[model samples]
Target: MDRQTEFVLRAVEDRNVKFIRLWFTDVLGFLKSVAIAPAELEGAFSEGIGFDGSAIEGYARVYEADMIAHPDPTTFQLLPWRTKAGTARMFCDITMPDGSPAMADPRHVLKRALKKAADKGFTFYTHPEIEFFLLRADAPWNAPEPLDSGGYFDHTTLDEGTDFRRDAITMLEQMGISVEFSHHEGAPGQHEIDLRYADALSMADNIMTFKVVLKEVAVGQGIRASFLPKPFTEHPGSGMHTHVSLFEGDQNAFYDATDEVRLSKIGKHFIAGLLAHSHEITAVTNQWVNSYKRLAWGGEAPSYVCWGRNNRSALVRVPLFKPDKASSARVEYRAIDSACNPYLAYALLLNAGLDGIDKEMPLPPEAEDDVWSLTDRERSSMGIDTLPRNLENAIAVMEESELVAETLGEHVFDYFLRNKRAEFDEYRRQVTPQELETLLPRL
Candidate 1:
């Protein structure tokens, strides 16, 4: 066994871990776990544990159902807030029984994208500003009531859930997830947690773990934490405005001291690529029927496709640069909701950015004025574009995009397209209470 595997073995024994959970995610980003006793862990590390992939959504066809879960030793950590006997978990990579990477595996999708970046001597890093809501436990599942009536940065008294948030942060820290900041967000009962920047893959895993920890901590209280993109139509919706930067070796590739915004040619091109592909990747980033509600609403959710310095109204914004902090230079992509599948979302993002780098796509003019407030004439004159307005439209956009199809590969691309189409159809078929309430009384 290698050093990391051996270390995990020793650590599991010392920690008195009764079970080691092998965790991965489906295409929709829902976490899936399978546990093994300590006696079976060494074998799992060497040979991997087998599972029926066909049973998993977007995984495999019935005939080709056999798949293996190879636990990632680096991701080994004890599950914090586990009420049961000592339990640990590790993220796993799904592969075919013949040792080939499963093309449908979201992790494999990201790995391919990362390998492309590596080929160019670049590494992608991300810091996500994840936002969600804390609601009363007994609140109706469909219409959850906020636990508190506080808004943005509301202190101890206003933000009544400080203890719960603190407990969540503690649990996350215990599991080795570093949270940079946690504060009450603009919406009532909504909060934002900014995770420390890390490589895309590790950060994706951290995000998945972060959500679980948040919910677990919330359950411990008399409340429930939700990651639904737009739980309340009247209030601002949750968003995962992600900060992205690229690096080469010890230096930041995105930074250019000579440039006005301190952005390198590479950085500018990368942003240009992102803008060009924003619509194409929208389905993957904000992949839900309700996600469009968040996108369509113009508050913090961006509908227009444009980039600018510190312009929250634009889909992409280059955060203000500090004179001494060159490493902090990055672009924040604002359209992604907190509920997205980080694995596929991050993969698509990296690929989109790389496409820009590869094609040397030129950066468009910065939209200093609020793109959201602009009239059609003004936006048209400025070449400003808009993202897909709904899930069905987003799916159609994804279907036609050669770039999206190529990035996701045939299997995932086909599966994702079909799955999202069905979701949109189902959503369309439903007669929402709002529709009935307004139409029945009016007509």
Candidate 2:
């Protein structure tokens, strides 16, 4: 057995872990879990635990229901919230009965994209500033109530949200997930947590774990947490403003010492690729119906496709470079929300950036003014394009994208498109509260 596997076995025994949960995600990024006793750990490491994939969303047909979940020992961590019988969890990679990687598996999709980057001598890294809302646990879904009314970075004494964040960060650190910062966001009840940067695959796994941990912590505190893109109309939406960079064997590939902006040619191309393909990939990054509401609602989220050095209004922002810290130089893509499927979203982002590098795509003129302030005519004249106004439009654009299709394999691509279409259709048939309040009495 490998050293990591042996180490996991030893840790389980020494820690007295009675239940080991095997965790994986479906196509829609929902966490799935299956628990096994301690005695099955060795067998699970060798041969995987079997499950029926037919029941899973976008997994397989009933005829081909047999699937395996192989635990990744590197991801094994004891659950801080579960202390009764000593529960531990590890992220799993799904495979078919024949031992081939499942095409529909979101983790496998990311690994494939990472392998492509590896072949080109590049390693992708991501740092996400994830935002969410803390709401009253007993509040109704449609008329939800915020737990607090604190503003951006307000250090209110005796704040419940603050205590929740402290506990959440402590638990995350206990699991070896590094957190850089936590603060109150602009909107009431909304908060932000910035996780330290890591490799793409590990970061994706961390994001999934981060979401679960936050929800679990909220439940323990007798409150609720939400990652919905646009929970309230008047408040700014929750977003995952992710900073991404490429590295070449310990060197920052995005840094250029002699450049005016200190951004290398490779860095410019990466931004160009993201701008060029942002529209097509919007369905995956901002996948829900409400996600478009956040993008187009004139909030902090960007609606136009453009990049700038310090302009938060633009879709991509290149943070200022510190003199001695070349490693910190990176580009932040702001359109992604905290609710996205990070695995597929990261894969598309990496592939699009790599495509730019491959094609030697030119960077466009940076938007010095606020993109939201510019008139439509002015934006059009300046070659600034807006993202899809709604999920239907986003899906239509994605349907014709070869980059998205190739990055997400055929199985996932087809399933996601169909699922989104169904969701949009269901949404369209509903009579919204706005419609009733606006036209019901008048009609």
Stretches > 4 Å off in candidate 1: 158-160, 321-324
Best by lDDT: 2
TM-score of 1: 0.98
- Which sections of candidate 2 miss by over 4 Å? 321-324
TM-score of every candidate: 0.98, 0.99
Residue-by-residue lDDT tens digits, candidate 2, 153-268:
99988789999999999999998899999999999999999999999999999999999999999999999999999999988999999999999999999999888778899999
lDDT of 1 by residue, 1-443 (tens): 99999999999999899999999999889999999999999999999999999999999989999999999999999987775799999999999989999998888898888998999999999999999999998868976899888889989653458887788899999999999999998888999889999999999999999988998888878789999999998999999999999999978999898898889999999999999999899999999999988887786689998998878898988998573477888889999987899988998888888899899999999899977788989999999978999998899889999988888899999999999999999999999898999998999
Q: List the pairs of residues colliding in candidate 1.
A: none
TM-score of 2: 0.99
Candidate 1 C-alpha error for residue 278, in Å: 0.6
Local error of candidate 2 at 259, Å?
0.6
